[model samples]
Target: MLETPYVAVDVDVLDRNLAGMAAVARERGLGLRPHAKTHKCLEIARRQVEHGATGLTVATVSEAEVFAGGGFDDLFIAYPIWPSPGRAERLRALAGRVALRVGVDSAESAEALSAAVGPLDVLVEIDSGHHRSGVRPADAVRVAEAAERAGHRVRGIFTFPGHGYAPGQQHTAALDEAAALSAADLGDGVRSGGSTPTAPLAEGGALTEIRPGVYVFGDAQQVELGGCGWDDVALTVVATVVSRTGNRVIVDAGSKVLGADRLAWATGFGRLPEHPDARIVALSEHHATIEFPAEPPARGDVLRIAPNHVCATVNLADELVVVRGGAEADRWRVAARGANT
Candidate 1:
């Protein structure tokens, strides 16, 4: 038996999620390159490859290095990276070791990246309604031309429909993504766009790939947004109730493990799959205040918490307790846990 306040992944649920995503990608004739920033585990990454993922998408150079070092050959650093000296050296080394691709949105970073990594494959990022790290769709060709002028091979354009996370926004965000990709005149190449919320609806004449990461481990946010059902949740934080008063039960899980990301639409800090009516009303460094529908459970009762965001939750974990038949089956290291650069 393992200790409380630990993260556990149901192998059966995970396999089903993997197979479902692979089937979706295959049916759409889109390349599945699930983002590794979700699980950040070599075991899960290997499973994604085995399940038909053409490659993996990472957020940072360190993350790319970790997975590439762990034997994943094709990696796409999806973020617009302005390389520091150390990051440049690492990117150069990674380029020599794997099929490395990076994103660029400006000429300055493109020129600097070329100087640092020496003619690497590049993708110009197009803004798909998230308005985060990408240029306007009309500016995609401009960025691609700049990267090409900097001696980098411009592969294609990509976007992230981050706005899809909200309720009733997925279909619109997907439409925006498709429109953006259609407007980004980058010739014929990989036009990638996707998020777990928008993946099912991601369709454009120009789309050739999708990079959704969170489908492997359903979370509270996904559940609330109707992206996945409670039974589809594969990962949960197993916490023990330490105190109970009236209708409130305080658990051992906190922001340190569950992450501090609460979307505006989220009902609470987290949720209890076992107690569907209970809500984690608040969280401190090491405690969660749950509001129960009725009389609270007695102290020492175990609760499985689905965090509002699984990516941040996985990043906080050191290992994922693989559960099978309601028992611990194995432990998988979060190999890329601290790979933030």
Candidate 2:
């Protein structure tokens, strides 16, 4: 038997998720470059590629290096990376090894990227209501031109539309992303857009590629947003009930393993798929306090809890116990875990 407080991945559910997303991308005629930061597992990444992923999107250079070293050469670091001397050297080497692209949002960053490593493929980041690290649509051209001046080729523009994460905002955020990309004049570069919530509605709206990270393993936030059903959750933290009260059951798995990323709109710290009404009310380092709606689980009863954020939860784990046909089939290393740089 596998140990408790470990991350369990249902391979059947994972394959379904991958195939579903691939079918959608094929139907939409959009390039599917899923964000790899969500799983951070080489096994999962290979499966994604096998499922017709055109390439993989990543959040950091370190993640890019890991994947590239693993022979997944087509990588796009979607974050607006500031090129320090060390990072620039790394980027330069990665470019030499693989087809590398990086995001840039400002002339200053463009210069830094170029000075550190010249003649790189750069995508200008446009702020489509996220108000994050991206330039506005109107300023996209300016940044693109600045990138050209800094010796980088402007390949396209991209946006996050992160506002879609909230309730009742997916369609609106998608519209905003389309509108922003439509308004931006970045020559004939590819227009990339998406967040997992906005990806479905992103078709035919100035997007050639979509980078969604969360669909691989539906999380509590995605469930609350109506993005996935309870059965769609592929990753969960396996824990054993250690204590019980009236309606409270304590599990050995907590934030240390499951992560603590409760969104403002989230119902609780995490969720119990086996008992949908159960709420992870409190989470300590190695304990999860769950409030069950019905009879509490007796001590020693094992359960699985879906994390609030699948990405954070995956980052916390060293490996994923991949279950196929209801058996422990394999253990996939979280190869890119803690690659936050």
Candidate 3:
């Protein structure tokens, strides 16, 4: 057995998740360019490519570099990043190395990125519902036109159904995303939108592509939002119970290992799959306080914790311990971990 406080990926579950998403994309006639910001593992990315991903979507330039170094030829930086001088240099390098695409939510971002990385492909970001980034669907043409003026190739518009990660909101969020993209007249460009919760409903009419990241490792947020069941959770943190007091116990895995990204809808910081009623009440840098049922596991017992946010949790780990046949099978490095530019 590998040491506790380590991140583990159930190979069977991971493969099932990948196949499930790929099947949906194939059936919908939608392009599958899964976000690499979730697993950040070359092994997982390769598996996704084998399962029919057309390209990889990443959040940062460094992540693109890591995956590009791993031989992934096509990449999309799916964030409206304001390129600094250093980031501009890196983006220029990445542009030369791969089929690079990026998101542009404003004319300023479009112009800046175009000047930094000449002739790169740009996707106008439309604010479907999340109100995070992205221009309004009605204003997508302005951003696309600006990108064109900057001498960049406009690949069309995309939206993220970020609001879909809530109870009974996936369908509505997906519809909103579709409506936004339909309203944006991009003219034969790639209209993309989808989150893990809304991907199952993605269709061909409005979107030509779907870029979801957390499907490979369903998290507590996905579970509560009904995106996936506990059984679908592929990645978890393996922690050893160190101290116990009645129904509450301390585990070796904490915020540093499991990530501290509990959503408002989440019951706790994380979930204990074996003890469904248990809640991770608190987390220190290296310790997790879990409150379980009457019959709590004893000290020194190893437990698997499904985190609230799999993407952030994966970014915290250096490697993932692959589990097979209920045992550790291999160690896969999180090669893109800390690759935040």
TM-score of each: 0.99, 0.98, 0.98
Per-residue C-alpha lDDT of model 2 across residues 1-341, encoded as one tens digit per residue: 67899999999999999998888888888899999999998888999999899889999999999999888989999999988888888999999999999999999999988887888998999999989889989998888888998899889999999999999999999999999999995767789988888888886648888999989999889999999998999999999999998999999998899898988989999998989999898999999999988889899999989999999999999999998877899999999999988
lDDT of each: 0.93, 0.91, 0.91
lDDT of 1: 0.93
TM-score computed on alpha carbons, candidate 2: 0.98
Q: What is the lDDT for 254 in model 2?
A: 85
The CA-based lDDT of model 2 is what? 0.91
| Runs with alpha carbons beyond 4 Å of true place in candidate 3 | none
Positional deviation of residue 123's Cα in model 3 after best superposition, in angstroms: 0.4
lDDT of 2 at 131: 94
Can you tell me which runs of candidate 1 are displaced by over 4 Å? none
Candidate 1 lDDT tens digits, 213-326: 999999999999999999999999999999988999899889999999999999999888888899889899899999998989899998899999999999999999999989
Best by lDDT: 1
Q: How many backbone collisions does model 3 have?
A: 0
Displacement of the residue 68 alpha carbon in candidate 2, Å: 0.5
Question: How much is the lDDT of residue 190 in candidate 2?
Answer: 81
lDDT of 3 by residue, 265-337 (tens): 7899999877889989999998999998687889999999999999989989889999997888999999999
